[model samples]
Target: MIRRLFSHIDLMVRLLVLAIVLASVLPATGRGYVIAQGVSNAAIFLLFLLNGLRLPRTEVLRGISHWQFLLPLTLWCFGAMAVAGKGFASLADSTLPSTVALGLLYLGALPSTVQSATAYSSLAGGNVANSVIAAALLNILGVFVTVPIISLLGGGEGISLGADGLLKVMLILVLPFIIGQLFQARAKGWIVEHREIVTWMDRLSIAVAVYVAFSGAVSQGLWGKVSVGDWAVLLALVTGFLLFGFGGSWLCGRMLGLSRPDRIAFLFAGAHKSVAMGAPLAAVLFPPAIAGMVLLPLLAYHLLQLVVSAPLANLLSHDPNVG
Candidate 1:
């Protein structure tokens, strides 16, 4: 009986960890004020630090050359999604805040997540090293360049970018990642032996993030601010964005002349945005009310992709070229 349950045990364990975190929050709403805020902030900071430490310094400064295989199509994929959402925004204008329009646009403007790209690349049999390097660089550069795009398309309610933002990116994100990497290297053998521990943190972060997002909203009584009708519209937008990512990334993969495996990596890595990154950026870029609104799409997008993309990823990896 235990053996039967142990099939895909890693995935099961991950889900279990998330469930535990969710359970923890249900008790006191996870709103220990300073404790919650500090832990949440440290988790993201430490997560990035691990990223920095894991990646080569040279690569961080001067990324992999796969843009020949990725950039144009990736940009166009995100661009078209932004246009599609805005095009249809008129239908839901009455339900969500006008800022929802800006939130949708701004989240699309941010770069894809680094770690998820690499994780999916490995799962799909892509060049893991290349995907890892590319993902890290794109995110680092995104901190610098993502702001201008937001400013241009964000109309008026987007984030501000400059030296200050860059500093925050480095201190909060880059430094901690470097620390994690250095610490990992010293204990490289130990880490390898304890791979399960790191894996636990990966899933645990998602669970923590979900609980924090939901609990924070509940604690503030902000859950009441948006009604069922508004939620329906948010769900619709999330669905559209996920599908757009899948379809758009596919076309980009073709345009970039990627072999099937590379295409699979490009599609998942290049297209998935980080709510982890977005939440902080939103808080910095917009007003509190608007930032909360901005996070809605990211929250929706994160959950939708986790469920929808497992099957999609499996299908992509089975392609002959991927094998």
Candidate 2:
């Protein structure tokens, strides 16, 4: 059944339509809003756990040693975006607020994605295990690193991570994967076999989140504060960043003279970032109003990447040059 489903592109099309509809109503309905937030957190946890399960023991450990390109690139790309995005505020006419700083810091702070990056890597004919290791490692490191950097960049309005909060992040984000890893052989196979279920749940979760987040913005009068022009500017920035990360990683991997599989792995795995990962973490780290703003550019980035990256993935997949 799952194999038949995978053969049909229409399933994705249909699910996407459903996601669009659900995203429309998530904000106004209070129950749905809370459920969306819960699902967002739960889905991220599931994604991390599934990622850990796929990672071979060796690659998981080697993620530390294999800091070759990914580590520097992650920092560099994030730094570049922060510097570039913050300055973007001056070009716009919106009332200057802490969001300018927060947006820039968020550029530097959010983790690389786990499931989507790995899936993109796999779809692009990359080494799935290596991608999993890289993605998962990025996620773990994010808890320790994001807050301090945000604090530095944010100044008076910055964020911080207490020891207890860090512990809780580890518990919520790390411990689930640790447990999943113990039973991975059983779970991963089932998930892979039921790819439709996994895809549906993942997309449903994200759609609900976008709905709630965007809805919350409406309720908070973001439209009055953030104009159509601001949205356009934000959209442009996100598109550019996604292009840079994906293309830059590919070029970097090629320059490293990696094998085809490894280069492909690095390209896709190193490129993608997560907006979903930021929502809960932002709630934990920042004031509520500010947290929502922090989420905005990320949401833009996430959606832009999906639309832009799909064709890029297909192009890479069939590229005679890659092999």
Candidate 3:
């Protein structure tokens, strides 16, 4: 059981940690930084392009009909979580660096993860169809919705997305996704056939983004600004945020009277945040230094979710109520 649980700390997590460590020890600078950023941007573009190619339009269409489940899930992820993040940010403002505190809010406004959410939902005997659809729809909407929510909630904190930022998002994230979708008919099968390579591409792109972002933060004294006490506080706050996400999502499902399988889907779907989206979007929306700091809470939460989900999925799989 312990070995199985630890397996959740998979290769991707290790890569992420390695990226951070590399950034801490040997951060890119000057010409190297510029080159790294360009590479990171290109990687992000390819990542979204692949995302577009892989997700089936038919699944999205079918899932739209499950509005009974998706609607509440969407509202919870965007609305309730955004509010909770704002509250958490406010609480952390006095204790942590401003950018780090604001990270909690950014984390809240982001959408659910596609891969892990679906994988865990399946493991827990949830409605896999709904989980897939929910993940795709939320990520699609997140490209548009997350920034606006951050702008709305954190605008006073200098987090607004101006015209340039919007255009960058369109080019880097949305445009490639649209392109991939357009080519899906011709390319998706090939992508699926080469899924192993594509998955590694996804991981590599994310790792580059994280490495570039954290490099900037490290250059700007990221470690020095965040003391040990701040680390404890950050951990505590992240834990609270995780509990609220899973607990609130489950309660919302129960209150809406969803079936047990659906509740499991809701639990994972509503709770998990996407580092895939968050990292790339941050690269587009903020400078490397600010993006790195802004990603702190998200990075922590993403890792913890992986650790927690395996055991939780096992428990849910055995639950008599999960029919």
Best by TM-score: 3
- All-Cα superposition RMSD per candidate: 4.8, 5.2, 2.1
Worst 10 residues of 2 by lDDT: 89-98
Q: Compute the lDDT for candidate 3.
A: 0.92
- The predicted structure with the larger TM-score, 1 or 3, is 3
Error of 3 at 321 (Å): 4.0
Q: Whole-model lDDT, candidate 2?
A: 0.62
The residue pairs in collision within model 3 are: none
As for lDDT, the candidate ahead, 1 or 3, is: 3
Candidate 2 per-residue lDDT over residues 241-278, each given as its tens digit: 67767777777777778777778777766666665456
Q: TM-score of predicted model 2?
A: 0.71
Candidates by TM-score, descending order: 3, 1, 2
Q: What is the per-residue lDDT of model 1 for residues 99-202, given as tens digits with 9 covering 90 to 100?
A: 66566676576677666667776776677766666666666656556566666655545455467766766676667765766675675665577777765665
Which should have the higher lDDT, number 1 or number 2?
Answer: 2
**How would the candidate models be sorted by lDDT, starting from the highest?**
3, 2, 1
Clashing pairs in 2: none
lDDT of 3 by residue, 137-227 (tens): 9999999999889888987474646788788999999999999999999997788799899999999999999999999999999999999
Query: Residue 174 deviation, candidate 3, in Å?
Result: 0.4
Per-candidate clashes come to: 6, 0, 0
RMSD of 3: 2.1
